[model samples]
Target: MTKVQFRTAEERDRAQWADKFTAVAEGNLYRDKNSPFPIHEYFKLGLLGKEVRMLELNAGAALVDHMVADALTELNISSETEGNADEIKDWHKSIFYQDTLEQTARSFFSCGYAAQQVVRDIDPDTNENTYTIITLNSKTWYPTVPTFKYQEIREGRVVSIFSENNDGVKSWYAFVERHTKGNVEHELYKLENGNDLEGTKLKIKDLDRFKELEDSVATDLNHIPIFQIDMTRGAGKYFGQSIFAKIWGNLQEISEIKTQMRMERIKHFRSLLAAPAQSLQRAQRVDDGEALPNNSKQARVEQYEHQATFDLRQEIMAVPPGAQMPQFIQRDLEIITKAMEMIRDCLSEIASVTGCPRSVFNLDEKGTIHVETEKKKDRKYVQRITQCQKKLEWITEQGAKTYFQWKGDKAGKKEITAELDSAFEMTLEEKVDLYRKMNSDGKFISQEEAVRNLFPDMTEEERTEMLQKIQDEDKSLAGSFGDPVPVEL
Candidate 1:
């Protein structure tokens, strides 16, 4: 029998809150009126929301690796499976623990920076809102996108307080411990002033320490240490566990994806490097000059018949009757023989017989083949040779537009393009041609909006009919955009 675990009161409360969040997301409060969609996939966004999801995934992967290592050293495998476990371990390392550590730093400030564009509700250059949100790709370094604040978030109690163990809570101090390669105690041994935290109390560290820790963490930005250093609060706070946790979580996710991509690139490069070695072996075998296998029982007979034909064409045709038909010449005979041999070889490859030879053919001593061009008379020499011209319709127009005119000439080869639209009377061919030319690139202009740059000519109703026809009534589709219909857990 299988056992099932039920949700506790706390779990139930969390689930209910999630349900409400999803309900609110269905409304278009976050989006413009033109779109009907709400936020997507909120149910599985985790505790910190989608933006901070990297932390959870990173912590999860680390926990999994540690668990597997524990299981292996503790003999957690079956005897029936004889394969080595190193393969599994190596695979894990490649998937999680590789990186190219890059040292780069950036500072974010609410106030305008020296080099940054002066943004306001409207930027003078683009006429966009001043203080328009800026998003950079950060190709050189991992990108950190800050979400704009809207509401207040609750600050939860800190479970493990560091103030009791350390004299002061400093950024550099936290980082020295965070990136220390071993367990907490092992890291403390190598770290400076690890024991100094025992008696002092200065959570009010200076600006230099804060800046130093920030830059230190940024040093090996590729491989981020997270999950273990989860902040008490999540985001939208001053320098606290919440902010660091948010940063750590995002870095962990980026590292995970980069590791996967690097593995693929390495494998591809290895295979490409082996191509030359494979080609060399094939070349060496051919350099020895082994003769290709051939048999000549059928081919030899064809050669003899070819030679006889050549001799007959040259020696016999030079004189009148038997006088012109002299004895076969050896050189002429050899030429005819080569032609027959060539034809026979082709037949042998296909495993078939050649067509029967009806007449002798040979090159003359003057290197010319004879043709009967002198035997023509004057009457009906060449009946007025009438060439059959395949007439095809070619219709060109003022290429195309949202509107077009279909014109065709009476004597024109084209019966097509008589009408631009179906409402216009046109033959099926004409309509097809017009549509083909216009639609070749699969684009069309529709009667959309031509903005009212100036005022309208006449007065009209306060609200246009287009407004009434639009969906003003909010539909309870899946979620809500505005405040949700609250339901207590």
Candidate 2:
């Protein structure tokens, strides 16, 4: 007797997990449904193996994008002091800072951390040094070592390595960037002859053929120019865990359930035709008039059964004359309903793990029975969004300070501040209603306070202008109504 071994839950690889999460986040899962990858293993089962539908709700992308949208809503960053503030704003505009921050947040939420490189360049028009921030691919960048406090970069530094393949010449080369305090180094390497770059056992020696593009630059900053924004860091761990890690199992189950439901629905639509055993044993005429080989009748029946098995498009099943009329096999559709319920439960589980509302996943759209519960979930989700916003705010402020430090503007570095939108999980109508309710009976809240609450992104100047306009409108209404004399009678 032979013993079969199975992989334990603890034996699952983190890299494989990351790859699955990335695929879901990027909407790239099951590109070829027939592929024998482990991720697609569930679909390749039962009688409908090859024909099983690949239905993915892409909950990973939805969760990350929705959280990012909530976290970055109406985000605004400004300077608190005078020197080089306008220049900083201009640089941000030139580099599309808001879009870059959005992409950074997406990456942080999707991949557990976002890596960025600060590149300083000379402005052609002003001939002044300008700073631009660019995100590094998560797979290419590696951060080593972290301080016990705040998890800031320690002595080990950061390295970014990427490979480029030149198909025309059949060559593979690698670009490496090393970032440390006050210095950045760049190097290029070519793969050694007969050494495959993709080989599992390939080493640094295999890519040891140094190309001539070695470069290094020294900076005045006290820390590395690279920034790594972690989603959530564990104690003593250099890398953070992806937000999808907790909900990945639920996501997988949801996909499998949805796929099953789809297959069940297909089965319902194209019911199986049941006939007598000998009915389908007759062979059709061959175009070449070839004689039937031995066991031809059994082979014909098996072929017909295979063709008519799970094919949704097969509308007719022919049988021999005087044979019992084929009857459709009725399936209990209650199984599909049960599967749907299971999917909703899985989504609820995902919502619980992600702090996102189940409504965000498009569950229970027809009624408000779950409205209050979803609102509570929304509030909790908003709190998580606030936490994410704070992280992004810190990153933005640090990025600004770094830019100023690189430009030698010490005053600007001290004064830079970043603010992300604080209002999440509220519609504009809901906010307006809340403001009306707060001030309905009496003036519990002033107009300025209401405006501040309703429109937190407005600048002081804008707020003042808006208040003046409101006051003028009130005076005009009072004049038109002539409120003093008519009410007493």
Q: lDDT for each of the candidates?
A: 0.23, 0.65
lDDT of 2 by residue, 2-98 (tens): 2222112222243245445567777555665322123455555634666555776667777887777777876565565675557667878989888
lDDT tens digits, residues 1-489, model 1?
222222134433332332222222222112322221222334235432334321111222222222122112111111122432333234224433111000000101100000111112335698753221122111111111124433222111111112223467442222122222221110111112322222222222333333322222221111112111011223663211211122333323333343334444444444421112212221123223544335666556644554433221221222333232222222223434554454333322211111111111122223344343222211111110000000000011111100011122223222212111111234445534444443456442111110110112322342343333333443433336565777899
Clash number for model 2? 0
Give per-model TM-scores: 0.14, 0.65
- Report the Cα lDDT for residue 250, model 1: 32
Query: What is the RMSD, in Å, between candidate 2 and the native fold over all Cα?
Result: 12.4
Model 2 regions more than 4 Å off: 1-20, 30-37, 40-53, 83-85, 122-130, 154-174, 189-213, 274-284, 287-326, 364-379, 410-414, 425-489
Misplaced by over 4 Å in model 1 are 1-195, 198-244, 272-489
